[model samples]
Target: MTNVELKEKIIEYSKEIGIDKIGFASADPFLTLKDRLLEQQRLQYQSGFEEKDIDKRVTPKKLLPEAKTIIAIALAYPSKMKNEPKNKKGERRGRFCRASWGEDYHRVLQNRLEKLEDYIMSLVPEAACKSMVDTGELSDRAVAERAGIGWSGKNCAIITPEFGSYVYLGEMITTLSLPPDTPITDQCGTCNKCVEACPTDALVQGGQLNSNKCIAYLTQTKDFLPKQYRKQIGNRLYGCDTCQQVCPENKGRDIHSNEEFEPDPDIVKPLLIPILQLSNREFRENYGPLAGSWRGKKPIQRNAIIALGNYKEESAIEVLEDLLLHDPRPIIRGSAAWALGQINTERSALSLYRAKETEKDSDIVKEINEALDYITSEVRYAK
Candidate 1:
């Protein structure tokens, strides 16, 4: 079969295998993306999760010497949960973003890419392929944009007309010389909803993102969340979708094409109190399969404490006090102290006072002192 005929076959096979969108592009160097990445690095905007080598990231040839074409594929994930659990006064919940709603997208996309690779190898024995999902060196969004899968939106998401900005992207580089498709035109004319809606102003400008301040990046971090961003993150336990949530193009766009992307209400919007008390095995067993759990239970538990603080769920004071006085991880202890301050109950003051006397970590000590000060000031003012 000719390269064109093979391409057609691949497209047909993609649909059969449940790939939502597919586009082909020549294996040319991403020069523009290289410049932007350098700028992002210079400004210290990187999230530290990206590949460190700039050359390896921008040049496809470096990844595969015989590279001649790239096949970019997008899988649409569900934006809204069907039977999402409710958050009440004492039974507050924290959320994992839409991307982490179901099974990890990396596994789902890789499975499709492997199937595609097997099909192509059968057609052309000489074909060589390298497939990458989100964690790979090459940027998935850049590959998708070049391959005409979608236009890169101001929110830093590849916005497909059919799926809006709610799609998971992955790509494969191959030695076969296939015809490339035309890229989509930028349709975000005069629309600034995403930029404005950013809780941390992570989208400094259209098509540019400062990942350090991004709530999505912030939520995944293992360290104690900075004071200013604690309120901004609200109840988000894993990722942030404010920018995409507010976009004009994404309005009313919710796809449920893939069953794997469907969310379990109890897992995605889990109760905050039980998460605080989850043992390692219990955490892994309950959340290990979801994408949000990749960073482990600490960050999620920390965010859960902060969510309780954000909600001022007074009912959580007892558990927060126990965590402040006893949790081994300083991040949990410190965040628990902060949450106690937010709750401002009479018992919370005594917990902070006792924690302050014994806390060895300077950071945790500082948080405890701040909590005590907040409580003291509130009491004095109320009198």
Candidate 2:
């Protein structure tokens, strides 16, 4: 079969295998993207989780030497949960971002890509291809936008006409020179809801994102969340969806075509207090399947502590104190200290004082002292 025929066959196969959208693009270097990446590096806007080498990120040929065509795929995830749990006063819950609502999307996208790769190899036995999901050297959004899968939105999410911004993207670079698709025009126009609604102002302008200020990036970080963003994190345990949630394009988009993308209410909106006390193995068993858990238990536990403080659930004070005093990870201990201060009860103040004396880590000690100062200020102000 000709490359044209093979491309059509692949598109048909993609639909059969449940890929929501598939698009093709030339394997040319992403020249504009390279410039933007360098600018992001210069401005120190990267999330640190991104692939550092801009060359590998921009040049498809670097990834697959014989690269001629790129295939971009997007899988729609559920935007709204069914029978979602409610966060009551004492029984407060923290939320994993919608992208993380169901199974780990990397696995879901990988399964589909692997099938496509196998099918392509079967058709052209000598075809060379390399597939990657979020962690890939090449940016999935850049590939998708170039392949006409979606337009790059102001929030930096690829916004599909059919599924809006609520989709998981992955791509494959191949030696088969399939016909490239036309990129979609930017439809954001004058609507700046996503940029204005960002609590941290991570969205610099229309297409630029400062990942360091992004709450989604902050939530995944293993270190103590910066003080300003901690309060903004609210009940988010894993990722932030504020930008997408406020986007006019994503307004009514809620697709549940993939069962793997369907959320388990209990897991996605898990109770906050229990998370603090969970053992590492227990955490893995409970949360390992979700994409949000990829950073392991520390970040989630720390965020959970912050959420508890945000809620000021008096019931959580005991557990937060336990973590503040006993948790080995300084991030968790320090976050717990901050949370206790946010709670700002007499018991929390006393706990911070007791922990302050025993805490050897300079940062944790500083956090404890700061928390104590906050409580002292609160008490003095009240008097």
lDDT of each: 0.93, 0.92
Q: Which portions of model 1 miss their true places by more than 4 Å?
A: none
Candidate 2 local lDDT, 1-383, one digit each (tens): 78789899999999999999999999999999999999999999998988878999999999999999999999999899889988899899999999998889999999999999999999999999999999999999999999999999999999999999999999999999999999999999999999999999999998899999999999998877889888899999989999999998888899998999899999999999888888889999999999999989988988999999898788888888888888878888988899899889988888898898799999999999998898899899999
> Residue 135 deviation, candidate 2, in Å?
0.9
TM-score leader: 1
Worst 10 residues of 2 by lDDT: 222-231
lDDT of 1 by residue, 1-383 (tens): 78889899999999999999999998999999999999999999999999999999999999999999999999998888877888899889999999998898989999999999999999898899999999999999999999999999999999999999999999999999999999999999999999999999899999999999999999999999999999998999999989988988888998999999999999999999999999999999999989999999999999999999999888898899899878889999999999999888888888888878888999999998898888889999999
